[model samples]
Target chain A: MARVHDMGGLPNQGRIVMDKDEHPFHADWEARMWGMNEAMWGPDSWTLDWWRYVRELIQRDDYLTRPYFDQWMQVYAAMMVDSGVATVAEIASGKSDGSRPKGAVLMHAADVAKAAATTRDFRRPADQKPAFTPGDKVHTKTLGEGFHTRLPSYLMNKTGIVHAHRGNHLLPDAGAKGAEVAQHLYTITFAGADLWPGEGRDKDRFNADLWESYLERA
Target chain B: MSSSYDPKKITEIHEHLHSELPSDPALRVKALESLLVEKGMVDSAAIDAWVDLYAEEIGPKRGARVVAKSWTDPTFRARLLADGTAAISEFGYQGHATGHIVAVENTPGVHNLVVCTLCSCYPFALLGMSPGWYKSQEYRARAVRDPRGVLKEFGVSVGDEVEVRVWDSTAELRYLVVPERPAGTEGLSEDQLAALVTRNSMIGTDRVLKKAG
Candidate 1:
């Protein structure tokens, strides 16, 4: 089943409004939320993949209706309680009951700049040969339900050519489950006509970075 | 929390209960921050530091500088296209949201556009926070299917002869489009050229740059 977050290629979305002078955050709380998110990044905290999975797990109605930061706020709350750092009661009342989670790595104020400047390397040493290389024809596998995947549903079962081999990177499917499984990533290029049929233009194409597990020999 | 505890259900209940009362996101965020701080899980100072860093130091200007240098220097342009991460690191702009960068250049016959269909995954370390419209559902859904239509709405009209290549950021790799330098800017300095590069042009939503007067 296609989750609400998988919104690519859907029809009748709306018009695009370009607000040239728009600020990144409209309110103070939004900025706080953004900072809070960045501050929570650490080894002991939830992985980015898990955070995205939780965001997708939000109920469809709330997912669609809530503001972007508000949705992130909900995800953070859920993750905090789920990880045992706090409780729903504690969150509701805005007070801790004197019980702190042990072994939680906290990001101190001094480490903020280093943390922001440092990039988390997701690439891992390759364990096996890459299944396909650039210029090879491949088809995306039909992803099964009930797991976090980076393969967008719109490209399922679609044939494309491997544009580039992106080396071994952590697969988000396993990363979301708290495991660090690495796989060969590829930039797959699909013709616009193949992806959208009669509605797509002939002079256009789409490229997506897909994992090896999400593709098969075509 | 028990083995049977469901976070999704709890979130639903919380939303349902909150609906009966006045809903204020600002208050909720404040409450969450206080709770996290009280529990010693997060630091407010760290949060403030992050907010200040993005607000003051990082943004599209960093990306503009990279693009401007690439426009004037063929060697830098080649390096940027060959390895975006290494080329960008020369400017000390390599950081979060830019782990494995792939810089695609826009030529006379090809135009490059970037979008994350699943989520709002952008080159935030270099480009700063994504715009509201870039994160909207409208752009995500239509960018992959109707590139011409979306570009037109952004006031960019790609000729039929040009092939529009939309990069869907589905994995960890981030894409940056090096837009073609606009015409009649041969006399401009690198700094002046950087000033003319807008954020939308880097995102491939705008094809035309502001002419230097």
Candidate 2:
């Protein structure tokens, strides 16, 4: 979906705030949200891409206005309800009405050691040859809305040259839908003039890691 | 030295938003956790441990060590610039959000900065969690559009002669900027050099300042 979250080079975004001494989690709730997010992401739980899709499902107005962690909290609460872990009444009442879902693993304290040891690897050996190699000119295919996509709205249909072939990795689009499909990834470099002609310097360049499905020959 | 929001302004915004919610954020989070625990849905201890791991054990120190070692070891530097995942793993910092690491060097003529304009996708295993300003909407929207301008606000003044390369982290590959080592520190040990490497420098927002005598 081309939501407000994909705001890369839009105008009037104001200046980047220089918070020299800022903490990662501004408030206690933010820390709790972070911890919960980590705890919920186990082998049996939702993938990061799935969580991102849940976040993208938030109403556009709230998605745009809420603070960073607030957005996380909102999406998490919604997921809890959507996945049947909790209900609307349970969250609003600040108490569980004894209607919790089953088979969630619970993520007990004993499980922390095992969970911490788990590692996620995106690479998968494949026989398919990479479509684009280093120095290959390519253009990103314009994609339609209504699905989880890693292709940024700013770079859609834009032309770029392949800078490097980053080995095959699980496609995020498939990962979001609970399926893992290995695809070639590349670091494509776009001229600053192409992304933002007058705003950016001519010498400057922007690079993005794009999957094979999102690219085609120029 | 510069901040777009002051405490007073933040307090005002908090108060305005506070009126809409039933309780404070801290208390609300506590309540939510308690409710989840009451129903045997979550383990509070696990949450605490997870937070501690990020806050204490994993951090930019790991990244600083990698930078410092690369500065002194030519072969390691070459491997790091070539295959960052395998190179960084020499220090035992790999796996989890580190699918395909790419180390971009900051040379005399070019500078590299990393950002996930769509969301906050960072190398958590190596750098721990991201900073607050990194995930801010303002930073996400403006970093790619005007990197030098953003860097200047962070007190990082890149010269007009140099080129700025902004890496928009759109995929699973994580990027780390090997900032140019400051001069006048030829005699310093690797540990001392690592001390000079700041998290902001690796993120390409600021440079490693010279060691003060």
Candidate 3:
């Protein structure tokens, strides 16, 4: 795809082009990943847990622009930084976290283990009992003139019905919106026309998991 | 330290995390060290958890199936257009999903498109999983700004005479569009008919079971 501009033979083509490295993904990562997944999990390896991650991330807008190796590098960097093996400076500078590292890490190896054991993967329960049943019309609550929501910007103030009940979830939106939210929020279905006005396709539709705090009687 | 590292060893170490035991809960450390030696990226277990949560029904292919079936059955189609949830549940498919459903039917005069300007809220249970492109921010942003332009890029042409209805799947309900089948597929079996329906058809770019191509 990047070659298209070069084919134009126009001046400043180099300047106009974006290098693959500036983004994510190494050219060989796919081959290596495919091999590993195939060897370990078989042909359907991607169809299972691994592929889901790939599909979700690949759908992100940055996938095309990101370099292949860089993608792996970034993921590697994030996991390390997150798990406390490296610091931001070490990652940014390409310096080694060989011995000692800087900065305050809330949880190192031992700490992370203890936390993991005790904390629980809170969001793990998405298939629990739903507070609302299908066919129920619910109105989105408009809390008094102030900013608040576990709902995404697109779903706020929209009316929808309960199409399904996933049980429970961590309710990230509620967490983000500062709600005293219980985990395992309900998954609801909103109408396409209701969500987007002119843009709603005649046949296009969608659904999302939401917290109780973001909804009310419609 | 400027050191020459063999990426092969890093890959080896990564594979080790799985075969090895958790005597020290060392998945994180192993990941950290391997990353230091090699250049690679991987989704964390948190990502895996989300993927595990994803269901196939919400995937594009199965989503396309639902739309195609609705096209084949008028009574169901009408029910779907009127009340999508009831229509779909009649076929025994109403689990783990939430909110209402709206069925948008494609017609000679109308074309439909789906997008979630917010985040990706697809039906994972039934659809398997989404393609790498559906949850994209590009799809979300561009689908809203220029539905025609974006669809065109994907080879979906909207004639000037056709009224394009863009359906935004928000955090509330899901919308699945039923596209009318093309000519010359009269005696085809449902499975045969299904073969012609691509995931892109459900998204409103390409279509299903056309006459020739």
Candidate 4:
């Protein structure tokens, strides 16, 4: 739902508070929420993109009203029940009568260091020749509706130039479906004026990551 | 395994979740976590470790060190600008999000700002979790649209002659702004220079200011 989260360019989002000393988590709940999320997610299980998609799936009102970690809490609860790791009663009562979560890739306390270093390298050798090259003009294709997409709504159908070839990587659109799809990724540079016509100067630019599927030769 | 959506049951769960959820959000979080532990989904100690890793072990200071080194060392700066993943790994700061970091230098003619616009896809290992505003809908909405206006609101006024480049970070590549070194700080040590670097400066929302004599 592009109702709330796809905030690329609409305006009037009051002052940007500059807090130089900001910590990662403001409240203990936020930290624990992060921890639980870290523990629940394993390579064999869900990808962060899937979790992000679920976050977007949250109801609009709750998405806007609830604090960040609170949103995570709700998502976690839903995941537990949805995955059959826990039931509604189990979550409500704050105790678990459920069986050991099947197919869970266990992450122990000692494994935190190792886990921190592990990141899914999206890059793979090109399946075919790269679709576009640096300096080539292209346009973004506004594909897929009602589901997760890395292609921002603001960039849809907009023109950009391929700034750099970021090699082939697992496409998030296909990865969300557990497809492990590989495609060429490019750093597409959009003239700020093109994205926000009246507001941006000619020299200003916005560079975004674009998968091959999301772009076409201009 | 039953990942089907049951609206009615989900509603009940949501109601109970919010209603019975303890007033103290932290305790409520703990309660939910304990339940997960009981269900054998997560280890309590592991949770603590993960939290500590983010809260303590990783942060902007590492990025600060990188920036300081880059400012003083031209070769490292070149490497950082060319291949941030390999450059940063020399400092022992290598991990998932650090893979494809692209260091955009702040030149006299151009200034760069970083935002996800889609989601908060930041370099967590180098810069730690993003500030709250970095993930805000307003910031996300406005950053790409009215970057100069956004900069103005952040108390950063860009000159007409200078171009403002906004980087939308993705999971594959992250951008770190190597802020232009302030004048009159030629004698400062690398560590002292690192101390002057703020998270916002690295994110390109604010500039690193020089200290008074």
Candidate 5:
């Protein structure tokens, strides 16, 4: 089934609210939610792909209606329970049972500054040559059944030109399963009309970063 | 306490009480935080630090500074277009969500807009936290399909000769649209130029300088 998160090209989405004085957080709780999500980061943290996949698993109605940070709160609670870092009852009651898993290292307040400053490099050493190059015409493949994929449904089975070869990076399909697999990535540029026939303008174009696995020679 | 027995007044008081109660999600977040802190799994102070980092230290100002420098320095502009991550690191502004940065330039004949259809992937390290509109369903759904129409709503009208390019951040690479240097700013300093760059311009929703004004 197509996931709710793959929302590109779906119609009837309302007007975007433009506020010049927009701050990142509207309330203290929103800030706390953002901070809590960041504080959970560590060497053994879950892959962002997994985090996104879990979010997509939310029921469609709730997924569409819930505020952004509220969705994050739901996903974080589920992840904590799934990873055995916390219990559902404990979370609901706001009390711990005084039991923690072995080898759990608490993230200290003092180290957060250092952690936030550090850059996380997602690129990995390539194991094979790139399958496509810039200026080459390629067709995006329809993705098979997978719990997580970065390919938006709108771009599937469309023809585009490889604009640039971005070096090997962690494949999110595998990363969501707790495996780190690198694949050649490229910036694929498609004519706007190709993505949406009558709706797109003649001169408009769209670009997406696609893994080699998602494309083939046209 | 006065025994006010009017049914309408009692109903109004009931509605106010319900409205004043914390939302379900908010209460859930508070509960989760309390549980994690009680279990020694996370520090409350650490959470505050994370908030302060984005709220105070980092944001669009960093991107504005880079944009300003790129406008004035030919060497820096070339370096930024060639290798965004490296050029951004030269300013000591490299961090999370900016691992593979791609700087796309806007030209007189071309415009660049960005969206994340699958998720809201942004270069937080450089541009700071994303604006709410950038992550909305309307922008993500329509940016790639009818970009000209979407831009019109943002009050930006691209000419027929100008091509609009929408970058959908589907993978690791994060994009920073280098907006066109506005006209009539030749006498302004780099700092002044940086001040002219708005967050919406960097996100491709608004023009850095309006054509009329």
Candidate 6:
């Protein structure tokens, strides 16, 4: 198998586990403060070289004192501050007026009204009936490989049934950022044995939420 | 497989993922961070209006439904094995896979589990949101290390002769495991079969069909 990182080697490093070291707070207090989600955020994708150098300066052993999400936040702040992307002062101040970028907020509300009209609302009536309907056979497109979607890479170009047709959605992708992203998303399902015959359960299957733009019925 | 990444590479990639944001960074950051806070992430709600315009939505209570159908429908099962995405839609759920979306079957002699060694990769359509456990290092580690041991904790224990396989989900496509039916479930409707197959079963933590003594 062409292992993504370690592939399927050591479960501790590779598989998802919540144990001692895996604990965000369990690492060196310094490491924790530096914001290393360890498994959650791998150095492979991000050029940790910047964060790595700065983190090493701390001589204290990594600390084990918090949860995974907390560590993620710490890292987010650290990066903006460390890279001059945002300064430590900015993180402390929580505003970007002149020097720092303002931090974002997350809230729980079903209504758009809950969203202050003041906040920039990017949502448009992006819903569109899928070109393919339920039962329609479709194929994911693998056209080239520049950043263009939020669909998992593993599902591209593969053929499967149209499991669902959720209304319009946005593509959470690097290039698809901003008003330029495709609007709606779709959910596609697949069988277990189909992917890994030996490993899959003959009885079970899976599906995903894909934007209409992601499909091309087979 | 361990990431070939050094710290430098890791940070670089993250910065890229961060910069990839197209929304107003000020607002987007605030939104994501807000969710973090709500989830007890850190303490920062400097900004609001954080939800995504196009929120990803997956079906709830449907993953098992599809599994149940396949268990009872041989033709559908054949189609699913041949083309998972299409098969799933036949019952009204959509699936997407690229490069290679592999399916691992959960059974009496075999058990299958899925995880994103890369990040929090999951098939949202059928399974809805991935449970916190699926995203935790605890699950990833145990599933690969001692699947049997982990399953026991999840209330599932396979035979010594049974084989277990774990899938490492990727950005390319997500993976899901089909769990076998419970014993007393025989003669039950497909809907009934689907009901018995919990998300845990698909993940290989628990097998289907076990009655309390």
Clash number for every model?
0, 0, 67, 1, 0, 112
Error of 1 at A88 (Å): 1.3
State the DockQ, from 0 to 1, for candidate 1: 0.58
What lDDT does each candidate get?
0.85, 0.77, 0.46, 0.78, 0.81, 0.46
List the candidates' TM-scores in order: 0.95, 0.89, 0.45, 0.92, 0.92, 0.47
Q: How accurate is candidate 3 locally (lDDT)?
A: 0.46
At residue A108, give the lDDT of candidate 3. 25
Residue pairs with colliding backbones in model 1 are none
User: How would you encode candidate 5's per-residue C-alpha lDDT over B38-142 as one tens digit per residue?
Assistant: 766678988988888999998999998999899999999999999999999998888888878899999998889999998788999888888888888888898
User: Model 4: residues >4 Å from true position, as ranges?
Assistant: A18-21, A41-43, B1-24, B211-213
| Native-referenced Cα lDDT, model 5 | 0.81
Off by over 4 Å in 1: A42-45, B1-22
**Residue pairs that clash (backbone atoms under 3 angstroms), model 4:** A7-B141
What is the DockQ for all candidates, taken in turn? 0.58, 0.30, 0.07, 0.56, 0.31, 0.08
Worst 10 residues of 6 chain A by lDDT: A55-64
TM-score of chain A of each: 0.95, 0.89, 0.46, 0.91, 0.94, 0.51
Shift of residue A116 alpha carbon in model 4, Å: 2.2
- Per-residue lDDT for A60 in model 3? 33
Q: Give the TM-score of candidate 4.
A: 0.92
